[model samples]
Target: MQGPVVTARSARPTVMTDGARRHLFNDRTVARYRHSLSEGVDRVAERISGADRPFTGMSPQRLAPEIAAIDLDQPLGDPSAALDELETVYLRDAVYFHHPRYLAHLNCPVVIPALLGEAVLSAVNSSLDTWDQSAGGTLIERRLIDWTAGRIGFGVDADGVFTSGGSQSNLQALLLAREEALTAAPAGSQLPSDRTELLPKLRIFASAAGHFSVQKSAKLLGLAPDAVITVETGADRRMRPEALERELARCRREGLPVMAVVATAGTTDFGTIDPLPAIADLCEQAGAWFHVDAAYGCGLLVSPTRRHLLEGIERARSVTVDYHKSFFQPVSSSALIVADAASLRHATYHADYLNPARMVEQRIPNQVDKSLQTTRRFDALKLWLTLRIMGADAVGALFDEVVDRAAAAHDLLAADPRFEVVTRSHLSTVVFRYLPAAGQDHERADGANLYAREALAASGEAVVAGTKVDGRHYLKFTLLNPETTLADIAQVLDLLAAHAEHHLAADERRLVRR
Candidate 1:
């Protein structure tokens, strides 16, 4: 009898007996997590929105040592504890991109409308792999694509897919171009040789000012990095059409096949837009695929005033647009649109068990059919809701505000004797530096200015990024926050100039003593 007796056991997870609903997913844990998220969002909006810190750098891997021993399978402490931890360890670590003083790089403020959509989509976990799973989600995403194509004046049948961001969009576009080359060639033929010999002279042309992504794309496409021929740009950073033509001729003389002409609607450093109309014409005459990396400038499509910047974007066979950049959506809102949707037939793959169309009639978009992704997030929800709530006019006007702010910063810097606006505002970015006080050495002062930029960022009170152009290092201010003001930028310049003067004067005294 004593041997047959059982010992007391610990509590187990509650299993509902008279179940009205059996929770298939971890609803309790998930609900707790969501509540915590909302609280953290509120706290962040309240406290840090007005705080002037450049960034809060926290990393999950950094927390591995602390929580590594815990069993994550078991439910985390109810919502309150989770939110507090998220706030302390995760959110506070991110750079408050919306801050007016955050002039680091391409990151920008998150629009409110889009933020709400993000929350809903995340909760729904809508997978856009097929129309059956997506339903209205597919329709909404398709509508967004159509709206963007219409803005760019694409042909009535243009097609597109939402993406994580510009880099992925660019990758997909190049992949499509590679596929086009393969499918267009003779049947039973092998892949075109990436070498200059077999497919020798296979060339991918882009402006020197274009993003490095194009070169990476070429390399990834089996065309070696050397295949990316950097065409010369004029003083304005726009690819000189004449120079592009010269490169094309040189490639042909050497027996290289021109594969594609990649143009930039917005150069990364200078925000310079290549004359797309000219580039499009050149690509047309040469019979090369035309692709435009319009990640930074495609928002101009909605801008009635600045649409002229992209005169021939519609002529491009494919285009990349980052909705996060100009539309104020959160990070990872981007799309790749093709003028001819059928060209994507090259990317289509057949499967029986997963997406077999043997018995069913496919609808307008079975997104998996036309994307680089299969289990895609409902990212289109944010952009779609953003456009729905504010419409195109509001979006365009925000862009105009950024442009005006850049101009304001440029004029202010140019007029000041101690500061120099190196380049006028190109879109929302300005390149400038602290000009040494008169009797100060410009060469020595330039170096000091560069040093000051790094120093400011290291100080952590305020951060303005730095970059080099034409071999000279310069400080760069990318104004993306609408809440930013002239005074804020002026303060940043004053801090940098003062820091430079201090360092430069010390250097002069040291030299004199020597």
Candidate 2:
């Protein structure tokens, strides 16, 4: 093995030779990063091509000791040796989402065009915080934002900024809504000397199926715990317009300010879209801000056939779209778009060292002025590259294929006697649980279903997710992989049934022993 390369000719630090400086800096000529980058890519490619399963099925107990043995104080000093150690320590056991059997979360196998953009963006290291920091990069990001706004059918006054994820986007949206509400309140309604008092009378409304981030945002915004009022849902798990209207009327009678009404375009577990048109009308009548969390369903913007699902979305004052979820892009590709661009001024913070007022007067585009983050990544490149190469229609087709597969899988589960499938999929998720045998009660059924999900995950032949509906445990199939077929889902279902049966048999044995 090659030892560490040393070029120091003298012991004194200030008396460095030309070769030592070159080696330390690792410039183009000295370190040959081109070769190093190629090697790293090749290592990951080899790992992907050689993997036998989606996961290694290794328990944390066995992996912890191996990871703890690494000595961080001393460097490995050799690139090839470090790569070998990385392969053994991390890559061998990492959960590969690209595998056909992995249907756990909203994670999608990234597209090739996005990968190309990632490579270039990382190499260039452009920060989209200010216009001077990233001249052309700023323009590219703004142009992409404009294109997204146009697709959402927003008017000419619409504007937005990219965020870290759906959570951040939602938080920022609520912040703007709160600011807008405070600005519009009658004089003396809020004590300017003590604005915290207004939090008590402020309220936000969302469906029972809306993202948990709604309540989280309320908490973060210093509103009371009861500030978020969850409206009722019908049999379809969508928000009932009558329930929302009644709640709005009560808020008015109680002197509570309806700050905002959050509508979900696609929920997390069931993928159910709330009644956006009715909700929009209610918000308009109540004079409350309307926000749509379309993080998981924004892909329908380009979906040729399913575009009607997002009909009333354009009416939202602000909208959250996570391109990473449904656009086949990698993580952290989400934006918070607003219908009225002036609402974004609530997030602006003027700093003399960065985005100054002078720059704004000059009409120079500084993304930091509209973003919650100061130093943001150039994530727009990923979507730009995807649109340029694969075209938006191709991406939409892939999403449509997954939705179609999800429908077929729902039928397969519903037809099976062993499973009690939930409602028909509205987007691309099928919520269901394993049904116990005829003699078992509700408690036993829940236990058996929970055990089946846990056992399957431990076995690692297939990875799935679990959630609770109506206070009972249920498993979920979040189908985002277009390549995954019905056979794959059938095999996974077979595994789940076998595991549930094993758990029940073991429980019976325990009872007999007792």
Candidate 3:
């Protein structure tokens, strides 16, 4: 109506200047990308090579101010300059998990093949949600899922999706179980059709030693506050089947529906695996969904000699595995595998613009349909590359080495007069504490142990973890690094003992002065 509102094309300069254009990653900037990445890699390599200990003892109080002082609004412009700034803020004091003395958590030193896969995946930037977006990425992830399911002894109906970590995997597994419980109300049971009315009656049974994520997942699923029933564990820290049987009976008598029974394949602190065979039998009798959080003990799946440790895991409805923990992959590589593929439909939702219901009918494989996350990374590439290059047996051997190291460490602590070890783990964790003089009271011992952990961390000599066992403070050595030898464990133990002794002596002097 306004005469077509014609506009003239002006000869204006583009906003993307040559310098800014050079910063972009494209066909033309391949050399720049390679050079920049090489510089960053060199810096990391230098840090790893120079680090004498696992940590620099950089406390938050000291490092926080240094980080907060930086003017992030001011860009360095050059990648090398930014990397140099990173060295001061991050690389210099970063916890080097590759260090043999880093006996803290389930962090494993990554393999080269996985690192290579990381580089490629980051560059490609594939979002593994739909077939159109990911193409081969979808297939690769599916293949990996199939391979993992096969290893898990899941039949042809098995399916799964990669997740951010173990927590998310566990959360999704419980979510699926919750949905199943709601829909498949027992033949004569009184489960309300409305979710709100029935949600309060649902209960999850997990061992006292199981990961806290179970409780967290239950909360997130809108279950009651006391929804998670803690089943007692034996002296070995494994879930007692007898205790579970009694709990199941109690739940039945109380008219509470057993939604899921979570079994820990490898717990966080003690690394003790629950009695899977017995737990599986109990879950079957109770008609509860069986889930195995094999985040730490998933290595046993590949272990040539120790595969029997996970005897009844094949019967689990769902399982969580963290490749980062035992397979030596990089951080944030984990999966949730389910024996029945149909259960994944609980997580699927069709969006018209994205994965429409028609896509499924058309046989278009969209990973988002089965995943909790819509925009997932191509993390499967790392494990794929690792398997292709090193093979599963090689990865399992590395895990075996650490398991052996942990067993040796347990023996070392058991024989030591200055230390007291807890239950021996079938996996790779040893919980112990430095014992002071026999005259010291429990309070003094606890204070000394706490003081020693803090002091040792402050000294930058080594890094270890602390946990409470039976209301008493204890130290934990989660041995995931295969390079950590018995000598390294002995040295760290000596350091801890010295620090504890120093604390006790200082305390005694203070008492005498008082």
Candidate 4:
């Protein structure tokens, strides 16, 4: 009987008073959403803190099939109930990368401050392409470019733009290098219609151990990926200077244009660093573009201890740096920097809406003049906020921490007779695998290690990655977490070694059964 007081329409929406066509989201709704978000975050933090148990493995897929069965029709019921189902169905199975033991990839443990900056950035939705849209955001991003360039030793003339990540940065570097290569060609000979005839038998050079990205960049630039002349490496896994010089001589004699020489500050798979200073001299002597892909290793710039590792980085005409990789910034914080901002003129194009030729006359600093993207993200904010909060020295020290921790992990694993380290630890990766003493050979030991790793992941233990090093298999630990203690690494190794031993013994038992 009390329920009879209910009105036909329970309540009026506040936005309707202003004669606005109704939006599902109103100011009050947004306020509620913010509160809900805060609540959810607090709950997550508490859940993590409440955990008395350690993570066992991260095997990737353990969800019920019904949850993932997709039908595109819009839901017709209470939305909150549907969302709850989805959280358990989909998100529950997702790898918790932030879990301290999930030490698999280059993706770092993102800092809390950077996450806060990102929330504000997503709301503003400023495109960095135009100063009109971005305003203060543009200035902040430019300052970051300047600060990074100065670290690379590119004085006065250095300028760069924030990119999506290393791949995009590499593409832009090669684009500029291609533009520089055709310097003497007819004015019209450029990308969008790069005059093919003007293009020489252009060659790029890099170490054999350089990331596949260097070759990929070459392919994207209209050169065959295989056309990149490979230089043999010495025992340290660095590009041999003599082999590089010999190749340069051969290219010159064959009337091929030597366009660029790429040097890796830290290679992807093995963490190998090509000898930069020696490579720099070769590039200078050959009059080739010296492009350094320091995407993984550029953080060394701020590291007082490791700064010397990248001594010749300044000689690079252009460089790629991924702040996300080692700077503890969120993902997609990468930059492509050139020694002279004028080099960016090559990437400049004219469209009625974008960087019109008239704007160039006014000397307006349109980011579109240098960027590969029309609609780009404001990725610079996270890195800018991070650097500002921690200072250069602190960030550098964190990188030092990664390298040091990785070395300690290597020492710990090496001390155990059960682990066969394929390569001595370098950078932040330790390449090794469990080795059983008697029953199995090297091949079977590798198999056991691989299976052991899978079992570890399947059991929700610790996630460790595997890779081939020098034609042999290995279990690799790529550390980006500065807080990852030696004890943490030791526990994972011990678990892995124990698992491999059990598996090996089982294999031996199976053979005896046969």
Against the reference, the lDDT scores of all candidates come to 0.79, 0.89, 0.93, 0.78
For candidate 2, lDDT tens digit of each residue in 1-514? 9977666644346634543454442345435566667788899899889876678787889999998999998777667888999988898888887888888889888998999999888877889999888898899888888888988989899999999999999999999999988778777653343457666678999999899999999999988889999999888888999999999999988888999999999889888899999999999999899999999999898898898999999999999999999999988799999999899999999999998899888998889989999998999999999999999999999999999999999999989999988887678999999987888665777888888877887777888989999999999999998989999999999999999988888888888899
Ranking by TM-score: 3, 2, 4, 1
User: How many Å off is the CA of 453 in candidate 3?
Assistant: 1.1
Model 4 error, position 331 (Å):
1.1
Off by over 4 Å in 3: 1-18
Better of 1 and 2 by lDDT: 2
Please give the ranking of all candidate structures by lDDT, highest first, separated by commas: 3, 2, 1, 4
Poorest 10 consecutive residues of model 3 by lDDT? 5-14
Question: Which residue pairs in candidate 3 collide?
Answer: none
Candidate 4 whole-model C-alpha lDDT, 0 to 1: 0.78
Q: What's the TM-score of every candidate structure?
A: 0.87, 0.94, 0.98, 0.88
TM-score of 3: 0.98
Model 1 lDDT at residue 442: 75
| Top candidate, metric TM-score | 3
Model 2 clashes, total count: 0
The reply for model 4, stretches above 4 Å from the true place, is 1-30, 43-67, 70-72, 75-83, 184-200
The reply for model 1, stretches above 4 Å from the true place, is 1-34, 56-76, 183-200, 357-364, 438-441, 509-514
lDDT for model 3 comes to 0.93
How close is each model in CA RMSD to the real structure?
Answer: 5.3, 4.9, 1.6, 6.4
